[model samples]
Target: MLPMEEKFIYTDEEKERSEQILTELQDTLGQSFLENDLPKLRNHLSRSIAANAIRRNVFGLNPILCALQTAAIAVKDIGLKRDSVLAILLHQSVQDGNLTLEEIDSRFGEGVSKIIHGLIRIRMLYQKTPVIESENFRNLLLSFAEDMRVILIMIADRVNLMRQIRDVENKEAQRSVSEEASYLYAPLAHKLGLYQLKSELEDLSLKYLEHDAYYLIKDKLNATKAARDAYISSFITPVSEHLKAAGLKFHIKGRTKSIHSIWQKMKKQKCGFEGIYDLFAIRIILDSPADKEKMQCWQAYSIVTDMYQPNPKRLRDWLSVPKSNGYECLHITVLGPDKKWVEVQIRTERMDEIAEHGLAAHWRYKGVKAEGGMDDWLASIRAALEAGDNLEVMDQFKSDLYEKEIYVFTPKGDLLKFPKGVTVLDFAYHIHSKIGNQCVGGKINGKNVSFRTELHSGDTVEILTSTTQKPKQEWLNICKSSRAKAKIRLALKETQVKDGLYAKELLERRFKNKKIDIEEATMGHLLRKMGFKEVSEFYKQIAEEKLDPNYIIEEYQKVYNHDHNLNQPKEAESAENFEFENPSTEFLKKNDDVLVIDQNLKGLDFSLAKCCHPIYGDPVFGFVTVSGGIKIHRCDCPNAPEMRKRFGYRIVKARWSGKGTSQYAITLRVIGNDDIGIVSNISNIISKDEKIVMRSINIDSHDGLFSGNLVVLLDDNSKLNMLIKKLRTVKGVKEVVRI
Candidate 1:
């Protein structure tokens, strides 16, 4: 977030300042004995000071100074931990390749490494690119999921740069960083309760953006500084004396309003800076015990109101009831010495810290805290990503989520969103059931983990699959979302049905081979003996190999023998109820004199449909015509749809039962080069096959290509296909298709 270009050179004074910062940091975070012990806090500090000007960021800001200022804010203002501070200090080192994340992980801890990694990634996102797409901005928001501390630290870094940019010379980087601070960092600070820092960021932004207006406001404030100081001093004397009389330990200060606030007031009131009253407020932060915080604040309010007339409409007693964001103060606007309206705020030390520190203060002073912001932060980011491009969207992003959600990425960087508690299996199913069924586990952020690992907000997931892996009943327990559960159920059901079919086929084949005919009721009894209430379950066990097919067959033989006398033969079952190797073979079963599947037909006049000429060996069906004659058509014939729907009552089961004695015409549209003797080659090929005869050859030639409908008489479809294949092999024959 560096703004404007600056020289790489560091002044001697700046080096001393960095060393002083290092000293200050060590006191904040406890000291380390040596260079290699426990984050090596002092050791890293020494290196950072040495490496100050040696490394500069994209905006050419010195890394050492930026880190020092950012870490100072993080520790003093936000109450962050050593890990966060370490990340702030080491982010630039990691970015410049002078340090590795693994080294940080080993030296400090994983927490520090993760924070630095997030900062490094954010830096890389904008390092080479000036134009930030909406997607990248979205990634920036979601990156907080890696570590919300990153967000806090970046705001600190931006503030440091904004303060220094006035001396830098670059115009474009300055404007860019200024606009970001205005729209992005400023609002974020306000949300986090870093009000003082928030004002600083925006006022600096105003300086960069509205240069003339900023200086004008500054000049006015400067001209009245003496009088303003005298007034503030006069206001404080009475409050201080009253608090001291009450035996209260407190300090009071008057703050001049930020330039941005004054500018906004000027715009709203339609007046210049002089006309904008209430330019500053006085804050009375008390050092009160936890139990007496509220009482002491109310007492201070009473003292203030006694000295000056309080405005009833302007009094805000937040101490009675804190805001949802946990702001507690007693604010009063009173008529002061010169009939000027002055705002005064009273709060305890704890309350002030909570107010100044933003998210961390409430979380820390309240109780044990989570490193990541709760679901509200996630919900807000999701809403902003979905909402139109407005910084206010991110500003107000902290809304509670109706349904908790997590966003993940595919190996290819395709983003996917899922509800909270969704697992790796859920993500796989979200992609496809095929992947889900085959998924064994996955690699999250390149670390191999189980399929049951729950996803977080910013996870990069690459699903791992095995060809042999399949959905199991236990998978239902692992599933979170109903969609994944439903998919797993469906896959399991399909596999069961398939297994049942295989078992049924195997049983039928066994029964046929052994010449055993059993009733459906008898098979039901066998299934019950196998501990299955349903016949489908029996077959499932068989397919799963829990119940061997051979064992089931043996049990069947014993049951058959027990039910009937072995000496007497039983009547064979009807072929219609039989299970053949396959349907096509049963229908096309051949015999000595003819193909021998009985159609159970008497003498009926049958003719092939002229629309789709049916040949022998083709799967054909019989449709009785309106005139009582039968029309034999291929199962996939064009006219079959009309025939079946319009005249379904007249249809009958049919198949070829004998060799075709009658020849039928089949046309082949052949396209090829207009080569001499090509026509003779086609005709000769058809004549050489004694079973097929060329009935007609009609060729049309245009521009070296000859196309013709060659009609031939053939009794079998297989023979026709063979002739087509043979003609294709002929030179100059480019295309041949059945018409």
Candidate 2:
């Protein structure tokens, strides 16, 4: 007899059940499953379930094993390889079980284990990080550095969850997952070239995010289904026959616009769903080789457009320059037989496969990453991570991978894609991180603007950079892309740290000039004496010229009442010795003897120009020959040249002596619907005293509408927070906008 079989852990029934799943897969996949793939799938499930069983002892849930089986079945139907199928089977093993890397490798081979490891990395997002949701997502994208397959499987898992979210008992959990599916996964799927998955995820998300709205749209779509189908059929049938007659073998199918899509168009266009033109679409799948696909598709497009009156403006040639996601299709909107607009897409079978599978199939079949041209995309992310703090890394990681992209071009005629609202800083960094770190200014579409200039589509950005000009902490406010923000933040931190060290040395040198030896300890003590907790705090005050080093020496001298015998030389005279001063008498005399006219000057009733912001130290020039006699402006103001040209003889140079003058208030009319705290906040910003002084304050609100105007007195026009930053912070202030 054969040697007695060793004792087995699994019972016969369990073995048979596992075998049954394998048989079902074989029956479904047929010869496509292959012998190697069949053994791999069976063995993968067996080892994975065994590992999950250990986890079940503690957590008491083994749904991961079932999920694996389901995913294997799903993927098998797609004719995926053993590696991808095995990845599906063992994806969650490490997440749920105590399986080590060696255990996985021993059972599933290195390739399979690596994919599983990627899955494990993705799973860690849910557990390892402090942030549970978005941060987890952020970590997931960042961790794709080691292996990207984990992300693909993770997306697949998300798609599966979206499909079966109703099975979840917790409504809140269902909603959360649904929203995540919609917000994160759907867009990611689209980005990865998984068009079908993207569409499904979006449809499922819409179902939950706005159930009532989704259902209403679904009902309307269903009502028009017959008519829409008939129209699509009539439209495609002729085209399909013509293509066939031309010896082109192509498959044609009709598509209805998704509810979410229809709703979006309606919302964006501000019209009813009925107003949507391309509610029905026709997708043509051509049986052409990969190399000839684009040419053939264009030919097909020409033929179809010839038959139907093509809307020239509506044609989208994605085949020429595919989306960042590698989605390649020829799209056109044409007037159909019924005189209504219809959309059409033409692509090859291979293109359709890649579009549906996205990055998953790219690796699953080709054994490489997706070619949506994200090689550099991911490299930038990894670089950002390696060079940045966790927050910066997370920000770059999210924006690069998940943010909405806008395609812009360079002067060299190269296409550069950026996130929506990305600024010139983002473009600079995208070109070279150093350029971004040192970007001072740029020209967008040939007009000089700040680094913070918001980029628009088709604008050619020329980054003006200087190694001497480092990023400022203030750049955090305007740079929208994560990469630029992270680089700016890193540069700012480094600069601040360097400045801190330099400030310490400068302070010590200054203290030495005062005959005081300043050590770190002495500086700390001095800061505490000044109610500051740290020496850097004191240094910052000195650097900003808020705290004078000379004053510190005096304070120290007063506190001790005697000098220490240590013969240390003090630093040179501090900045305070050179006080802020006005123009000298000689300089003032040179400017046409401009003086406060004691006699009513013949043509000079001076009023400051609202736009030019002329302060006391500014080089002022007066323009006479205006309604407001002498319109004082900064000499470099844009309007100065125009005024000087029109009335050159009337222009007069003006200067302010170092004297405090009574403040002159400027009136700013704010026109926004009145709301809570708006008036109070505006008054607070404009008034020094709690009491608001107004020449006239008007208020009007009718039928729940509200708007108002406040006229208040201030010391000078310089203190007018009425329009810029302060007014922007007020609630319901639609426009703090200068009038």
Q: Compute each candidate's TM-score over C-alphas.
A: 0.44, 0.42
Q: After superposing candidate 1, which stretches have Cα over 4 Å from the reference? A: 1-17, 32-55, 58-60, 79-82, 124-145, 236-254, 282-332, 344-739
- Tens digits of per-residue lDDT, candidate 2, 529-568, equal 4445445555655565555567677556543442344434
lDDT of 1 by residue, 436-491 (tens): 99999999988999999999765778899999998999999998999999999999
Error of 2 at 154 (Å): 1.6
- CA RMSD of each candidate after superposition: 23.9, 26.0
Error of 2 at 718 (Å): 60
Number of the predicted model whose lDDT against the real structure is largest: 1
